[model samples]
Target: MPRIDRRSFLTSGLAAAAIWRPLGSARAENFRTDPFSLGVGSGSPKADSVVLWTRLILDDASAATSADPFAPVPKQVAGPIDVEWMVAEDEAFSKPVRSGLYRAVPEFAHSLHVEVKGLQPGRWYFYRFRSGNAQSPIGRTRTAPEGVDGFRFAFASCQQYEQGFYSAYGDMAKKDLDLVVHLGDYIYERTYGAGLVRRHGAGVPSMLYEFRDRYALYKSDPELQAAHAAFPWLAAWDDHEVTNNYATDRAPDAPNPAEFLARRRAAYQAWFEHMPVHPDLAAGFDALRIFGHHRFGSLLGLTLLDTRQYRSPQLETSASDDRPERTMLGPAQEEWLARTLGASQAKWNIIAQQTLLSERDTRAGPATGYNLDGWDGYRAARSRLLDAVQISKAANPIVIGGDLHAFYAADVKRDFSDEKAAPIATEFVGGSITSDSPSEASLAAALAENPHLRFASDKHGYAIMRLNDRSAEVDFIGVADRKQRNSPASVFQSFAVSDGIAGVNRL
Candidate 1:
C-alpha cells in the first residue's frame, strides 16, 4: 500500500487518475455501505452550470480515523469509488438534463464535485448522487437568470449546533427561493455556553480530522440537510468557521503564528470538502477565494465578500482609531470589489458580507466605541467601499450581513456620525439561525444610541428578501425558541428598500 498526503492526492492529477478505473461489475456489491451520510449540496450556480457535491462516508472507522487526531489524515477507502449523478427537470428525475460519472477518491474524502453545465438560465432542476445501489437525497438547484425582473433569496448565519436546533432552516427550506446565501459562522470551532441542545461530539477542531468531523456532525442534522437540498447556496465564512474572531493569518489567542496557520489550513480543507463551492476557489491551505459575484439577469447582482481571511488583526478601538492602513478586504479583493461594483449594471447591487457594516457603539457615554472584530474596526476600508458604491452609481446598493447574533436594519451613510451626509446604501444584519443573542435591554440601548439603525432584534432566526424591479422587501423572521425543535418562525419585522432609495422603510 502507498501513502499519500491530502494535498498531493488532490493535486496529483494524472498520477491519481490511474487509480480511478471503473468499478465494473462488482460495483453494487462493493458499495453496499451507505456513503451519502453527509447528504448532498449544490452551489456556485451560473446561467449554464452549477457544482454538485457529496462525500462518500463509508462507515466511521474507514473515513474518520486519524493518527495525529488534529492533523490532516489520509482517508482509507476500499478503492476508488464510482459516483453517478444526474440533473433533471422534475423531482422524479424523469426528464433528465445531464448525467455523468465521477471517481471519488480517498485523498479528497471521497467527495465528488461535479460541475454540470449546458443548463438553461432561471430554471429549476433536481439533482442526486448515486454510488452503486446506494442513492443520495435529491437536491434542487437553479441557474442565474439573465434579464429577469425579480428573484427571492434567504440569508442566514451563526448556526451553532449545540446552542439550539436548526428549525430556522426548516422554515427556509419551505420558501421558494432562487438561492440561499449563508453569510458565515456555518459551524463554531469551539464549544462553550450552557444548555446545549447537541454537542459538537469532539473538542475544538485544530487538525484536519477534528475539523472534518465537526463539519460532518453539523451536516448530519436533518434540518440543515434539508436546507442544503432545498436550493443552491452561496456561502462565505466569518471567524467561527475557522476560529472565533480569527483575522487573516492570525488567531488572537494563539501563542504562535505557525500553529494558528496550521489550524486554519485544516479548517479550510474541511470546509472545501463539505461545501458545494467551485474547485477554482480552492487555493491550497493558506486561503480560498470565497468572494465572487452572482448575477441574476439585470435585476440583481450579489457580491459575496470574504471579510475574515483578508483582514488586518483585530484592534482595540477608541474614538480616534480610524486609520487608512487598517484593512478588512485586502488590497486585491478591495480592488476586485470596487471594480465589480463599478461594472454592475443590475437594478440592485447586494453586498453579501459577514459582519455588521454599520457602526454599533456599546459604551454608555458620548465617547464612541466599536467591536474590534467587525467593520467598525476597519473604518477606512468601509468608507472606501461605500465611496466606491457612490462613485459607481450602483443602483440600490444593499449590504446584507450576519455576525452579531442580532438583527439590525440600518442606513449605510457616507458618514455614520454626520447627519448632513446623505445615505449611500441600506444594510440588513440578519439574526442568528440558532446561536444565542445578548439581552433585549442591551440591544434596545444600542439601537437608541445608533439612530442610523432603524430596527434591532435579539432573536434567533433568518431573513427573507423578496426582490423586484420596484423594491426589495426584507422580512426579518424570528424563531420562537431555538432550544425547541420545530419551533415556529414568523416575521418579527419587515422593511422595504425601494429602487433608487438608500434607506430602509419599515412596513
Candidate 2:
C-alpha cells in the first residue's frame, strides 16, 4: 500500500488506517466519564450520505486549557482505537441500518470523520458511537431529497464564548429545525467584549494546541453540545475564528506574512477538526475547501461561501475603494459562484455568506460611513456578484448572513443609492447568537439612512427560513435574554418572499 500524507488521506476519504499507525499500540482503558466530551455532530448531508463527527477527549491526555489552570486534561491515546458507529431507524438502535468502524488516532486529535453512505433520500436517522465501555450521545441527522419538497433550516453566527451565554442554541434546539447553517465567528479569538456572563477560560491562542484548547472550551458548553447532538451544522467562519478583522493574506495586527499565515494554518486546522464537514475540507490550509453548495430537494439551493479566506485588505472609504480588482470570494471562488449560481434550478436560491450582502450607509447626516469589512468596501466585487444574480435569473434569490450582529431584512438592490431600481433579490441578515449587537443609536441611523432595509433589530438570535414551491418565509427568532440561562426564543419579526418575486413582504 502507498503511504499517503495526512492531507491526502483526508481528501481521499475517511480512511484513518491509511495514515499508518500500529494497531497493537492501542490499549483498552476504561474511562470514568464520557470520553466523547466534545459531543457528536453530523454535516454535509446528501441524498444518500452524511458526514458524522466526534472527538475523543480522554480525561488524562493533557491540558487543553491555558486560561484556566484548574481545568482537567485529556488522556493520551498511544495507538489507533476503532470506534464502533451504528445508525438506525429508531433512537434506540433496535433497527440498525448502517454499521461501521472508524479508526481514531491522536494524529487527527482523535476525531472521527465517518462518511456514512447509502442512506435513504429525504429521511431521518439516529446514530451513536461506542468504544469499549464508553458511549457517545445519540445524534439526529437527515439526508436531502431528490424531488420537489419543502425544506426548513435556520442560520446564525457570531457566537463569542466570553461575551454571552449559548441559550440561543438551547432555544434553537427545541424548535425542531431540520438543519443549521452557522455563518461564522463560531469561536472568538479575542476577549475584549463587554458583559461577560461566561469566559473563554483561556488566553489568546496562536498555536495548534492553543487553538485546539480554545475549541475544546467552547465544546464544553452543554447547551452547545446539545445543539450539536440535535442537528448537523454547516459551519463557516469569519475573522474571530482566527483574529479580529483579518483579510486573507493581510493581517492588520501582524504585518509579517509568515507569522500570520502560521497562525492561520493553526486556526484552519482546528476548525476542520471541530466541524462535522466534508473530509476534503481538512486537506490543508493552502488548499482547504470550505466553500460548496447543498441542495434541499428541488425547492432550495444553498451556496456556502468563504468570504474571509481570500479577501483583499479592507480599504479606506474613498474613491480608490472602488478599485475593480478588489475581490471578496477571490477570483477562483467568484468564478465558481458565478458558474454555480448561474446554473441553480431550485425554486428559491439562497446565497449563504458571512456579513450583509446589501449596502448600509452608517453615517446619520451628510457624512457617509460604511463598514469597510463588509460588501460596501468592495463595490466592484459586489456589482459583479449582483450581475451574476441578474444573469442567473434564479427565482427569488435570497441572501442570508450573520456577521453584522444585528437583524436586517432588505431588498438587495442592484444599486443601493437608487430607489427606483427594482430589487434583484431579497436578504435576511440574522443577529449574532450571543455576541453583542450594534447600539440602538447606530442601528437607528443605519435603518434611517438605508432605505432599502425593510426591518432591523438589535436583539441576539438566529433566522429560521421555511421554503416551498409557492413562497419562502423567514422568521427572525431572537433570544429574549442571553444573560439568562433559560432564555426564551421568540419570533422577533417575520417576512415573506413570493415565488419568482424579487422583494420581501413583512409578515
Candidate 3:
C-alpha cells in the first residue's frame, strides 16, 4: 500500500507520466459504442476534498433491450483502461483545478475512484471523466463548509428497483440541498415480484460477480444517476445491501456462517466499488466499516452509523434478548459515538442511521413484539446510547433513520414504556425512496399502540431537513403513488425542534 498525500493527490501534475494508453493508440477516434453508460458521481465531501467515481461499460445494448432493465451487460474490452478526471470551477473546462489520470483495472470492474483534494471549502464544483474519445456526463458536487450559519440537506433510503421506479430521486435531484445522506438499503439482494415496473437481473446475489452485477444494474438507472450526479452523498448500508436480516457474520435465511461471510465480503466489495466513498475508508471485505462522523461547519455534526456490519445475531424477541450483552453498534463503535458526540461543538448533533430507535410494539396489544432487526432488539444498547447523550449534555441531539419503509416521527425517551419519562432526543425516520410499505391504516393502528410515535405515514418519498443555530426544521415529503414514474410528492407532515429542546413540535 502506498501513502496518499492530501496536497499532492490533486495538485501534482503527474498526468503525463501516469497516463496509460491502449495498444495502437492514435490521437483519438470515435468508436461505434459508448463507454460512459453507468454515468459519473461524487461523494464523501470534506473541507477540501471529494471522491469522484465512474465505471467503464462498453456494451449497453442489454440495458436498452432486456425486459429486466438492470441486467449487467458484458464489457467489450477486459483489461487495464486509462481514465482521466478533471475538476473545474466552471461547467466548461476553462478554470481547471484538479486533473489526473487513473488506471481502471479489471479486478475492480474497471471503475475509477479519483480522490481530488486541495479544493475550496463550501463551494460547488463541476467534474467530468474521459476515456479515449468518450466523455462522461458532467457532475456537480460541493465541499463541506468550515464554518457557516446554517445548512440544508436530505436523507433517503430503501430503493428497491423491482418494487417501483426511482421517481423519488427525480424530485430529490431538484432540491437545493448541500448534502444527501443515504441511510442504507441502497440495493436489494434478492429479486421480488414478477411482472413489475422493473426487474432485477436474476436470482439472489452471493458471489463477487453477482454482487457487482447487482450494483451495476441499480446504478444504471437514469434517475438514480441524476441524484448522484447532482450532489455529494453520504451513505451507509443496512441488511438488504447484502441480504435481508443479516447480522455479524450471520445470515438468518442462510445460517451457514462461512457461506454468509463469503457473501458479505462480495457484497462489501461491490458496494465500495460503486459508491463514491473516500479511498481510505474503502477497506477489504473482512475489515469493512462505514461508521464515521461529518461536521458541517459549526452548525451540524452528522454521525453516520453502521448497524448491520457489527451487530449480534438476531434472536427471537423476548426478555432475554434485551440483555446488555447484546449490541447493535458493537462495543468499539458505541464508544466512538459517545466520544464523538461528547466532543462535538456543533449546534445540532444528528445520528444519521438505519431503522427506528424508539420502541414500537407491532402486536397492537400488551404482549410486546419487536422487530429484532431494529434498535428495539438491542434495548440495553439503545439505553446506554441515550444515557451517554444525556450525560455528555450533547447539544440538541437528533436522530434520523430509515429502512422501515414508513415515515415516523417520535421522541426518544429514557424509558419508552414509561409515559412520564422525559424526551432525551428527537428521532425522525424517513420513508423509502421507491420500496413498498404497509398501508396507512396498518401504520395508524400501530401508532395507536405506540404513543411515543407522533406521526406515521406509509408513503414513498424522502425527507428534507434545514438546520441552523436556532432550530432544525424537517418536512416529511411523500409521493402520491410509487407505481407511477412521475408520481407527485407533497409535504405529508412538518416538525420543528428548537435548540436545546429534546422533543419535536408539530408545525
Each candidate: how many clashes? 2, 7, 0
lDDT of 3 by residue, 158-255 (tens): 99999888888878877888999999999998876554788895899888889888888998888888888888999899999899999989887786
* Model 3 lDDT-worst window of ten: 1-10
Q: How accurate is candidate 1 locally (lDDT)?
A: 0.83
lDDT of 2 by residue, 1-507 (tens): 111111010222223233223335345455545678788889988889999999887755334543577764545455677887888877656677887778887777888889999999888888877675566777888888789568889998998878778888888777766789999999988786677888877888899889988999998887887777777788888998999889987776888978999999989988888999887766677547789989877887899999998898888655454779989999999999989988898888899999999999888888888888999898889999999889988777899998999999999999988988888999999999888888988888898999999888999988899988888999998888888887888897899999877887998
Kindly report which residue stretches of model 1 are placed more than 4 angstroms away from their true locations once superposed.
1-29, 60-78
lDDT of all the models against the reference? 0.83, 0.83, 0.83
Q: TM-score of every model?
A: 0.91, 0.91, 0.90
RMSD of 1: 7.6
How good is model 2 by TM-score? 0.91
Measured over all alpha carbons after superposition, the RMSD of each candidate to the real structure, in angstroms, is 7.6, 7.2, 6.5
Candidate of highest lDDT: 1
User: 428, model 3: CA deviation in Å?
Assistant: 0.6
